[model samples]
Target: MRRLMQIACAVAAWASLSLPLSAAPTEPENCPGLIASRDALVSRAALRQDEVGLTFVGHATFLIETPQGVRIATDYSDGTRPPVPPDVATMNKAHSTHFSYRPDPGIKHVLKGWNPAGGPAYHDLTVQDVRIRNVSTNIRSSGGGTEYDGNSIFVFETSQLCIAHLGHLHHTLAPEHLKKLGRIDVLLVPVDGGYTLETFDMMEVLRSINASLMIPMHFFGPSTLNRFLSSAREHFPVEFSNTAAITLSRAALPKSPKILVLPGH
Candidate 1:
């Protein structure tokens, strides 16, 4: 089954990266064919965990602590990881900011996107209640040249959260890219406004996908942030926050689309 291979591949996928071996969590069942998988449900990650919380360390970086005491981290940095090991960690090869490892003994699985031959490296796989996949988009170099670096979109099924991290995304999402994205709950988008792509092009990408929450990343400067907010505000409400981490649950999600901008800590 697709789920089995993905679950099995989950171990092998991120093997090339460096992280604490004990941080990976046990792969959930009904993976590829998650019955809970819904297409039009845009809800917050509201899974009630007895002793868990989610934290966003930085650009495309997140820490998801599940109800079973399972903590999954995304794009962990070597010197930036928490003192404790996460049950699982997801990383992309787009930039150095998205990958790192600590010599911890409590972590379990470390996942990385697969680089393709003459194409973007995309490591697409699904875990128990988690689905971590990638879409290959053209990478526009500083001057010229085109490098195909795969962009990964991680979907947390149980949380009803389909999050797409545009790792140095050069172009807009292709037809296949949208298909893979399914239904994005919270999109971790980059807001260079011009550096990455023209505001018009970026707007098209935002319009193409119907994600409930659009979380901006990759850009700093108050003006840059303001530009992003202004551009996105046309389609949805932009809510800024002082904290990067949010405890999301399905029942507590927004009824309409919203943009949650968490402060960079």
Candidate 2:
């Protein structure tokens, strides 16, 4: 009965948090001694353009700068900007959040869609030593103008960190999707729970990747966050930091898999 009560409390908390979104989410940008990227997105020069540490700006947007001066920004948005410009940028054909071609200019290379024009298509994006691949999603709409936006799952071969971004994911991942997304280190996921898929289905996809760190994004409210934590807590410890943001070094990775719930950008 005690465990049941705990679940009930968690459920109540979840119910209360489903409000609405008026602004982006953030943690304070100032932390003494520690290197803080001006925003979730930063110029390559910010980390001194270091190769390793990754900074998550928000939903589907990450800043990757290699030790060799190669930088790539993925899925930029309206108000989102890098403290410094990047070497490359990736956008999808999904929704406004995932891709805004109008906003992007002066990018070296751009990977267009999830897959090729035909079926079973694959997009291989390799730059220097880093690679970001694309796997088509089944998010299709009727001839009424809905579309199946092929979402791309990126991979950074240099770091051996395969990161999958469920760009407005609409269904469970198929076997092909799983096989393509083999061995992921970090996962950037949506937590509106139902808007993407049911909680259980989304959770199963996350489990399939078995990523070391799962960062929740596209969340609706605190309740959505609570629901996600409640679900993941059973399989992995959900670490809630009162922190503004976290900086990850390859050397500082956790032994056991951990889910990090970060504020959105």
Candidate 3:
């Protein structure tokens, strides 16, 4: 009986030693639980199965071309119009430049980030190879008061990659917001510093999101852009691109978080 008891104790100790020291959960490969409901009427072959093309069309607008040729314009407005009409156009009502009353009629979907009826705007739809959703946040009114659920952070899921566009964001993200936004592979962030969140606060927001790749937008000029970049370099490596467009893939994402500065605002 004593010999049997010693053997049992040794086995238990060995099993405990074999267990991993830290059982921290691994990061998700893609945004889970975000499923696209609608199917696209048309499918145009353009990019590879795992590729997404992004063009910095100026301001908060980025032309996102999916693998199935679904074109999407972020912060779509008259000033930041893409050369080619997009299939889906997302707009925010923070200012006249962010939203348009009359978007091109050719656009199949016009998603507004705010509801004129005075509540949160909700959107969840899929077009071609992409699933689009929005998580609403608040904004500051002209009178310096809070406008609850006035802004949106649009998330685009396609090619196993999750990309988020932070539109005229006025504050940092909450825990609930992070839960809704799943795993973001790429982030389109506004670096105007004053117009959105201040540079430091915006950096905090970026850290909270922790996207592998971050693209800066909505900057007024080089001064504002440089100011943000100067501070950002301390935290993450910065890459300056000569062109305004770049193609991204999930498998090719940087191992370490990086800030990619594309030409144009």
- Tell me, what's the RMSD of every candidate? 12.3, 12.6, 15.5
C-alpha-based local distance difference test score of model 2:
0.56
Q: What is each predicted model's overall lDDT from 0 to 1?
A: 0.55, 0.56, 0.77
What TM-score against the true fold does each predicted structure earn?
Answer: 0.70, 0.72, 0.84
Candidate 1 local lDDT, 163-253, one digit each (tens) = 5566556688887777655666556677777656666677788788766556677675677878877878888876654344554544344
lDDT string for model 3 (222-244, tens) is 99999999999989988766556
Cα lDDT of model 2 by residue, 130-194, tens digit: 66566667655534343564565555544434555666677788876676565666677877776
Ranked candidates, highest TM-score first:
3, 2, 1
- The whole-model C-alpha lDDT of candidate 1 against the native structure comes to 0.55
Give Cα distance to truth, residue 102, candidate 1, Å: 6.4
Error of 3 at 201 (Å): 0.4
